[model samples]
Target: MMQLTTGERQLGAIVLIALAILGIAMAAAGRTDVLGIHGAMVLLYSLALLFLLFSSAFGPEPSPARLTRYYDDPIKVGVGLTLFWAIFGMFIGVWAAAQLAWPILNFDTSWASFGRIRPAHTSGVIFGFGGNALITTSFHVVQRTSRARLADQFSPWFVLFGFNLFCLIAVSGYFLGVTQSKEYAEAEWYADIWLVIVWVTYFVLYVRTLALRKEPHIYVANWYYMAFIIVVAILHIVNNLAVPLSFAHAKSYTIWAGVQDSMVQWWYGHNAVAFFLTAGFLAMLYYYLPKRAERPIFSYRLSILSFWGITFFYMWAGSHHLHYTALPHWVQNLGMTFSVMLLVPSWASAGNALLTLNGAWHKVRDDATLRFIMMAAFFYGLSTFEGSFLAIRPVNSLSHYTDWTVGHVHAGALGWVAMITFGSLYTLVPAIWKRERMYSAALVEVHFWLALVGTLIYVFAMWNSGIIQGLMWRTYSPDNTLVYSFLDTLLAMYPYYIARAFGGLLFLIGAIVAAYNIWMTVRAPSAAQLPLDEDLPASDRPLDGAAPTPAE
Candidate 1:
């Protein structure tokens, strides 16, 4: 009755044991530090996983026939975890936004404070929610495009659970006041090291699977995904170079300092947005958008152009964030220039996604899921343009350190990133679960409108709030003295802050609706279900007349 192969069970037990030992050492070494808490977590979670693995070991081995279909169990768990993180992350985000509008919500508890939960919200959504979605879809997309199963069963689960473990440790540490203090790289040295291990395995898993592809030519979606993995690995290693105070302690000093640190961090940071956020999801869009629309990519050449443009232009543009600062003026100007140039390819990619729907506009009109993807493309075009414009030195002067930057980020994040993910998941969930459709198509429409309205409200509020802040800060009276105090600006922001919080709440509610819908979809009885098969499963594409279409 084992759901996994004996080899897989053995591997799971071995890995969990190693993690347990590491956890024990951590507990002993860092009893006085937050490291101890993380250690306890690692130990407990490892034990739980071990228990689950062994409990199913008493039965006969799973049939090798599973190898006949796509390796989908990991994909199934990934779908659930993705929705789980979406709910958790989005809820925390709404709470954080609410805290900003109403300072009293933190309840005077240190753990509940804004400073503590803010990073949790960021990591929870960015890494937890968005990261899981990327990993899940990558697994699904790779198998279909290659017309091959995952290279192995074990590595997929390792990457999934290991990455989640790192996320848990990173976010939990923030509640304990342990951070390396870098933007988007806030997890301390230990978590960063763990992520590196998981990511390397992920890269190998992808490359190895692609090596066994039945298709002669690799697909464009795979190209973007590979770019995401390769570039992010390089960026994470470089930006996170640091020396821990001790193996037991969570604190660490970065290898970089002053302006050099700033440059390296953004070099990692902006490209993180480029590769992790943009490239990976664009991969999702490439495959799911076309498949869902039942259309080929409009212009294969445009996809390539956008891919290269993003890869090249985004590296230098991080400097634009440092405009009018201690960093060299020339560097700032260079960042600005590349950021502007980035618009061409960004627009190209967006256009390609939209153009794929040429004859499918009627489908888009009728299907909320398709509309989600279509609007995601529209927002992608808009947000990239806004990013280039804001990167201008003069614009950055006004927008920097204000809520406008926050608004611009969500315009891409909530609109482009989350929207595409939701659209794809809606399509992917039922297919993987072997259902006819979602539990409720009507609910999808409901979630779509909620998400759209929420994003608009949230973004517009920040835009207005940020502009007002900049103008007030820069304004002068006839006597040439500044007209507004910082306190005055703060007071003016309360109403917009309320609006932002309300919008965020709406988005969170939408995620909840999605969670329930997908949950029911999985629960709904289906007579035709893929038999849970074994390692290197073959897909039924050949028999069903649904061959793996080239996802160019």
Candidate 2:
């Protein structure tokens, strides 16, 4: 609170008080239901924040010297939260995988059931882990690229913590049976509204920071980050449009019904993969990859082309997820076509990242951090190819609703998204903390191998299980009856499920190792001999006057 001015302190109190009042209102309205419990949670959350605010209010004001440098406290906190969510999300994923292999693992608990925690795992990893990574990395990236501290420090922390609260509400709601049952958009109406408020604040903060930049042009990474923020808000608001049963309840009816709902949901779903998973991470790649490699982008023009290609093509490609369903044949074909076209840009990006390392492959061999990025680019290419191929109607016939789809998504998620993020964090952590290097370079190498082997095992096991399951369903005797029952296919999945759980376990362990390494790095005494390192990327430098003005 002391970091902020007196006016900011008053404004903070007002917001927290309003939130607490709203929570009380929700509790009063939904006293007989789970909604009331969540309302109580909100009350506690707000009051906790309020107390922390006032408790810190007596500290001395921030020095004007801070204005000359970047605002990185939020980024530091963000990195820790990212790893925390990664460990949590991956653990849930392993548990869910085990439940699939052995149903008894659920212990007959409703909250522990696969159906509930499945969304929880997905949301936790994607929005919780991935979202925090994006925010923190972007906060770091935007400052260097723009050559200015954030317009103010308040928005960064607010956006980061606010987004995490939404994630908590979302994942917790799943366990409590409080969802509206939309796939990635599963959070109930109140949570959805809260996210809109948070997201808008993020967008405004980003743009305002950019506006303060000394550079005349926005960096390519910022372009992708901006897309992630803007498109997700659009996708979220549109597909999740719903009329709540009442403010007193968590239940709501989506405005779209039947096939329309399916179409809208999938449209949001696949593109969530595009904008949220792909674009934001690509932003990480655009900035961090070259920095770690110490090479300029191989082709700035190609990067621009890939950016525009992704922005234009990905929106329509979402319909591919609805293949072989009630969606029109034309829509399916269009989706397939666009998805294939998407590979062009996707490969362009992957190739761009790889080609940037043409002279620096030795770094990749010597540095686990660079290898993490290298493998991510390779997987990005692989997953996009698989996705485009899977969208074909004939191919979809075999892969749709099969474990193949699950495998493909993980190929992107575990392989591309998680890999690149870890690589970036490894690079970011040392610089931010003014350390010579990580607490243990060997731990990073350990994580890299574990993540890689785990991803491969998980992806390959699902591939085998999915193909067998798909083939069995289509196989028939001369009598024209099915050759295998659904139970038979279900039974066949157990081995693969076991393999998947093991792979997820490896990934979870890697996350835990990462968290410990980061904590030790943070807590270790700062190295006084090291030079001042903001750890800014070299992709862009600020103009002479880009420094924060005294008034700022």
Candidate 3:
């Protein structure tokens, strides 16, 4: 059982009392106009407050400790949520893609329109799916590298449950037409507040656990994850600065106006992609790649260099998204310059990952998990190069509103983020379930090929169509008139859209195969004994009894 400190209890009580007082004041003001969604929000807030108070009063008690080793139940729950939400989120993404390809797929429903559903897809994948995966894996990676059991089951559960609950509110509110209308920051003020609380708890738990690590050296993955958590918290608070219309329902306006608002939003938005999608996954690659390959990291200095370089440069690149907009010319120039500079660190990590597997190519041939990770690294390199190129003003002019941007994003999201996630999940499932091996290596191979081919086709088709659309949109006739109607551009994209749909389908099939493989592995009977080879050190194991060096 875990116990709370007196200070923690007092803090919890104070928060609950404050919430109660606020609720009563709102009710007394007769400001029912803001009470619609705000009222519901207040109730939810009160409930969360009460739950925290109760938790502080009586700390968590484990459920009998049924397993011999502490099973890291919080991580397990987080993993389960990740899988569940991944499927749901991806389904939404595929549906949205289909809507893009075929307008009628929206079924004329307001809630299902592209505007409403697009944010849903983004939030679902980024927050619901990727968020859970990152939390789960961070917990797992931290415990393993640190050689320490998690601090407590309850706090982890609180972090996971609270985050997912926030996702639920945010997504539901989007469909209900409640929004701040900022891209990626679309969630209303209440949703943002909930996420802030959940995120702070996550930061506290993560920092505390790291402080208690049993290992001598903190692994490189921890650096990336820590950067992600801290930077994101800062970005969230700053970009989400808004005055609530009322607290009873989901309504608020961003405090920053005009070009300032755009600057803040994209600063948060692009960095959200950089830190959340890129940096965190890079951390996964750093830890998992060498562990799976059973080899030493290729370059320690390179990893450190890449980590610092990326951290310094990425925060500025968000301004590139505001290129040719109301943003100042100097700011945009800085964004462009930093974005270009980013290629060096990005490729440094990519090179380190690929080089780490110099003698492990044979394993890649047979290990589906390794294949996913390796391919993910390859795409990471590809996407970063593409991102830098896209950030150029001339290129941005062409690609900004075109499907090319869409293609570029999916190349990163599906290829880099999704692939790395799948690879990590593959590595994790057996260990978590105590299985000897996956159910079928052949199915994993099939999945790898399907996803790889699908992603390639999808990205290539979009690149081709997007360039064409951009050129056509910009071209004027000899008489200096518009050369193409919007409809003509739309028609030109039909083939590419169809190709994209096919690619998405193929990827979906691969995911399904992966899910089945994971399911079978989980269901498989435990081996009579653990494999001895699994415990053996590689021939090139580090001397001096130090931890293995981390790959970039």
Backbone clash numbers for all candidates listed: 8, 0, 5
Compared with the true structure, what per-residue lDDT tens digits does model 1 show for residues 226-271?
A: 9999999999999999999989898999999999999998888899
Give the per-residue lDDT digits (tens) of candidate 2, residues 160-245: 87899899989999999888888888899999999999999999999999999999999999999999999999999998899989
The parts of candidate 2 lying over 4 Å away from their true place are 529-552
Model 2, position 406: C-alpha lDDT score: 92
Counting only residues 3 or more apart in sequence or on different chains, how many pairs clash (N, Cα, C under 3 Å) in candidate 3? 5
All models: lDDT?
0.90, 0.89, 0.81
* Clashes by residue pair, model 2: none
TM-score of candidate 1 against the unseen true structure: 0.95
Candidate 2, residue 132: Cα displacement in angstroms equals 0.5
The candidate, 1 or 3, that scores higher on TM-score is: 1
> Among all windows of ten consecutive residues in candidate 1, which has the lowest summed lDDT?
543-552
Give Cα distance to truth, residue 350, candidate 2, Å. 0.3
Give candidate 1 regions above 4 Å deviation.
1-3, 529-552
